[model samples]
Target: MPPPPQKEPPRSFTARWAALKNIPPFLVMVWRAAPHLTIATMVLRAIGAFVPVAILWIAKLILDEVVRLAALPDTPDGLAGWWHSGLADHLITLVALELGIGIASDIIGRLLRLVDSLLQERLVIDLSMRLMDHAAALDLEDFEDAGFQDKLERARRQAAGRMSLMGTIFEQLQDSLTIATLGAGLIVYNPWLILILLVGLIPAFLAEAHFNARSYNLDFRRTAERRETDYLRQTAASAETAKEIKIFDLHRFLSGRYLDLSRKFYAEARRIAQARAAWGALFSALGSLAYYAAYAWIVVQTLTGDLSIGDLTFLAGSFMRVKGIIERLLSSFGSTAAQALYLEDLFDFFREVPEIASRPDAIPVPRPIRQGFVFENVGFRYPNTEKWAVRGLSFTLHAGETLALVGENGAGKTTLVKLLARLYDPDEGRILLDGRDLRDYDLDDLRAAIGVIFQDFVRYAMTAADNIAVGRIEAREDRGRIEAAAHSALADQVIARLPAGYDQMVGKRFVQGVDLSGGEWQKLAIARAYMRDAQVLILDEPTAALDARSEFEVFQRFRELMAGRTAVLISHRFSSVRMADRILVLHLGRIEAQGTHVELLDQPGRYRELFELQAAGYR
Candidate 1:
């Protein structure tokens, strides 16, 4: 069953306004993305802000000039006569000036839009890059945490979704300036007109703010559900899941589940939207009443000879423009606040600091090591879990030794390897490398020294050579090195079968890409370890997909190549286990037995029982 939707605390008006603090930092990010484009947008918008007032003033001059000419004695009777009399000169010039202003406004509007588009694109690119870099810096544990995953999902959406907020903010700036100029004219005529404008618009503005906060709260509460729906949608249609979905005939089940969640989301949104619409209509009617009331007063003053025809047109135009700008400014202010609330997600994700980072004065991992790793009474539990993954663990992996770990599922085999790589730090006790705490070594250097390929290694949808080069990406252009690594892992055999050889894209994710068999993919993954060629090498069930003969050959090559290197191998196959100089049997997150394979078998323990059971299958 789907879990109950999470509840979000009701957001107050003050809380929405408080989100405005995010705008400054957001603008800073925008500026940093493209400084010249940002500056151009601002300058153009500033100039455009005055165009409306200039056009309106020129329109008033044209009307007044016509009125004066019409009232003059001995006026010209035709257009040509008027030109000959020079009577239409000032009127014609006013019309041309207004036309020029209108054209310039249109050009400025287009330029602003072009600049805003470029700036927004740059911001999205910059934000996505920042998210990638920050996520890389985070600990593996952070990705595994559910709360962190939600934050990451929200931040990922915000990286692109918040681009609109940039344009909206600039529009608000331009509109605010327009309002100030338009409002000044209205105030000069009658301060009460400005008062009436505010009074009418306030109700609509308040209603918009209230509804926007509701929308944000609804969205915030539905984040996890939205993520689940997205996952379900992908699962039902993705190439990766297509085979299983078809085999199980899961289309109906998946589609039904998605529809159920979507309907619930739609229903909630519709409720708020309905309420907003109803209230908006009522409030908008009230504003219209206020505008007509002010218009009636202006008309009365004109009829009483208190204002000219030109004054009437100018007042009405200025009043209308001011009212519209103020309305939009208020409505936009609310929207900007709501968007700012979403910005919290992106910035919050950025604010997350990795707990497992190395110290500032961290030293490099020792080269040509005299000693190896020592896990002394190390204990660790995953975040938000009470159960320890590995507890009271003590082991020494000596330099140049090939140690094999034998265990069933959930026996902490993978967790132990992760600890060695410092993907996680021990909760209690410490790990030692060469007589010093493992935490003392520079984290990046420590990871570079150890190469690990796990059972669930990534199948990158990239060229075969690029796949191998990812292990040591700096050497990607070195074709000879990539081929040598592929040869060591027997991946060259798989590559030889591809149409494009090393250039072949070997995943089904992309167009014209070829898919490889499980064993073939394993060979490619093993090649990454060889490409790394680190001092410490680990193969954690990487050959599980290969046949016995192929696994044997791969291990044989691995043993040859791992000479003079510290190696850890985890496998279920007794044939491979017997080759290790020392073997550790793990059960329930602790060492159950430790000896050579023959030595363990002679002891008649769990190791022997498991080996004998496996051998029985052969008979």
Candidate 2:
């Protein structure tokens, strides 16, 4: 049965306030990430903030002087007359000052835009790097969790989208200062006008906050669906799945699913958008009414001789400027609150501490392994599931012994390998190396000491050399080692045939990439194990894709290659299993039998029966 879809728990008022608190720390992170650019942006914005108020106040003075000069007697059109009147000098000075302010404002705005773009780019890169580093530190089990995938998806979006939040915040800061300056001028004329403007803006702020929260909630709830849609889109169109999609005629099926899921999201978003627009228009009209009311009051005061024409012009302009700024600031604050909620995803991901991390005093794995692994009553169940993948399993793989594990599909062969690799820890018991718990050793060192290549190995979208180099990434530059490993895995012949030899791109994702046949790709993956050259080696059906003769050739020299190393071979083919010093038959997560080929064949049990059944196929 398919698993039930995960649902998001509803957020509370306190939770939203908590999300809001993340904004300060987030901004601090951005500032630290790009200190020079951040500071420059703020400095430029500060200078630009007060320019509007200064220009409006200057214009009022200029107008008052014009009125004063117009009332004076006409003067002769000569330098002496103009100088004697002082009007030309005063007017020229005011006009030059206003023009200078306008030019400075234009220059400051362009500089701010340039700085913001650079800072956003730098911050996104820094954030992506940190995200990757932290993700790499998490356990394999964490990556397998569905909830964690949802969180990761959200965090990835934040890595790109946080720049919008940063821009909004900077804009709000500059707008606040402009509003304060304008508000002060309005207050000197009449305090009640500022109050009226704020009152009208309050409803719009509340509406914006309400809609933003609703939008975020919808996005949060639909994360799983969104991720599924992305998966379907990739599956339908990506190069990896393209051949199967075409052969199965899955394009229409996938397209229908995508449309259905997208339509649901679109409907929810459209409803919220319509409501926001309707309410936004109503509140905006209210604010407009307040502005005109204030304008009318100022005109009446001017006519009543209680205020001068300059005072009327200045007060009206200040009221309009202050109202617009407050509206914008309040609206921005709402959007900023919603953005803070998204920041929670990014920060929460970073906050997740890996449960499988090594201890501060973790011991280094013993080199040239003296004693091999021991599984003592080991048990494990996958997360969120009741069925134990492996339980009460006890076995010893002695040093220099080649053990083969034969089992039916889903009989826990891969699970055992994972336990040995410490990709997961057994729930009920312990895995020991050299009589010490596997957990006691430094994880990196422990993994480095074992070379494992599973049947379902990844074919990296890189050069063939780089693909093999992944097994011992530090030795990537050692061309001699790469060639040697390739030869050992019989992949050297494959590479030799390639147009670019070792440097040939092996996946279909990039330009000039040459796709390899399945068996040929398996050859390259097997080469990775050879590159590792660890003390313990595991080949988990690694030859499943090889041709019959190639498989036989690989096994013919397997013992010679693994002469001094302890190896575990998991395969269904009795030909490979019979080559082991001991064959272990697994059934229902437990060891069913252990013996050499002849001994197991004589027992007349499942192993013998399976061997005869397989042998009959070729007859």
Candidate 3:
């Protein structure tokens, strides 16, 4: 939108390389790649260098003969020899050799151009894989961090820029070699000209370096804004917001906000480009002066008898080629600096390295739990939040106990369950398994001990069998066991009625697939959770989508399903929860009351009032 942001290339040395701290590592990568590029370029440059020196000597030999040709007598032999040296016939042979040098330079250019492409391809592939591996090792909490996510996104986008930097490095190396060869040729003709050319390059290089730093600073400052723009675009396009957006008719409202920010981003980009162009125009004028003066000096020396005709020809022809190589070398150096700036973001990402990297201390996860877990004064608040979601919370589920947790929205019921499942650790107190702190147990062991079904369960867009089998991904989770789980969750009825049965895809977004109704999806989710023969189980509003018939059957078989295991159940519906051995009505971040359902009904506190209200809803 709005022509995507303008990304014009650097115009001056300052604009290109002002951001670079050091060029050593970039030079290292280029140097490593030099063996292939340099071999071809060095061979061509040697030819160019030798030809010019030969032409200069030939010009000295022919100069005196040309000056006296008019006064010589007209003998036939004298005329034939005069036509050769008197007409600068040797000079013409020099021109042909210079032309051959031009051909060689072009050949070398094409060779580096082709080989650099293949090397960049391989380097980028290896770096991308490494970036992914590093990112995957970070802590899960870091992915949610705004700063970390922004850096990761910027690093990912800079993949092309990194290759561009490497290419610039290779190009600069080749140009530097050409300059060295040409400079040597210039010294042979007139040492004074070489000194003057070197003196003129300082201002141009400094200016270009300054501009590069400025551009890098600008890109760094815009990282946060770019991430914000991306967030807005995702909100506009994602499936998560589609239903609400359509209902509110907000497409235009959202689209205008996106366009406004995009225009602002572009405006700043164009401003930076304009400043760079003005700086480049100044240097372009200065470099042109050097071009003109060098030629003028060479011609003046030839007219005054200080330089021979062949020397004059060699100086004039080689000056432009030499100056052009020097300019290109400086420009590529600046480009490498800017590229290194972008690469700094990648290095910053590595500093955070993921927490998921394996530790040598991690023993194998015990396959099953022998004794159930205990929660002792567990308290938790997610990082950076002021309010605790659950505090002074303590509970225990010995082997074969089903403890129901009943609470309103945000009542810490779900928080308690997550702690029990070890998705998070308690802030103040420790949870234990048979007197051992849970942290002493392997993370994999703790997770494998429980099977969980969240209130917002995933409806996987896969075949029914595959979806259920995803729960126990370690083993070849049996098809027959999957079918048995479906029967236990009362989802077998829905499977029998499907057109393709167990093979049916669960989402209608694809060809030849049928999406299920709300209750059917719930049954599938419950069956998925039941796939693991885990020692502990958690069902948080597991029947929220089920019909009355399915709900009754699930709760009816609740004991057998939870047999020889520990469980914590969460529900707003009192009827389903009333079957538990004990009930806890949580209020705010603490347990308000706890008792058998009958005892709570007699007490007529929060639990009794809530249960009565649920009963009234049926009437």
Error of 2 at 171 (Å): 1.5
* Per-residue alpha-carbon lDDT of candidate 1 for residues 332-370, written as tens digits (9 for 90 to 100): 988998899889888988998999898999999989767
**Which candidate model has the greater TM-score, 2 or 3?**
2
The models' CA-based lDDT, in order, is 0.90, 0.89, 0.72
Write down the worst ten-residue block by lDDT for model 1.
1-10
lDDT of 2 by residue, 250-330 (tens): 999999999999999999999999999999999999988988888899999999999887787888888878877888899
Between candidates 1 and 3, the one scoring higher on TM-score is 1
Better of 1 and 2 by lDDT: 1
- Candidate 3, residue 52: how far the Cα is off, in Å: 13
lDDT winner, 1 or 3:
1
Q: Tell me, by TM-score, which candidate is best.
A: 1
Stretches of candidate 1 off by over 4 Å are 1-10
Q: List the residue pairs that clash in candidate 2.
A: none
Compute each candidate's TM-score over C-alphas.
Answer: 0.97, 0.95, 0.74
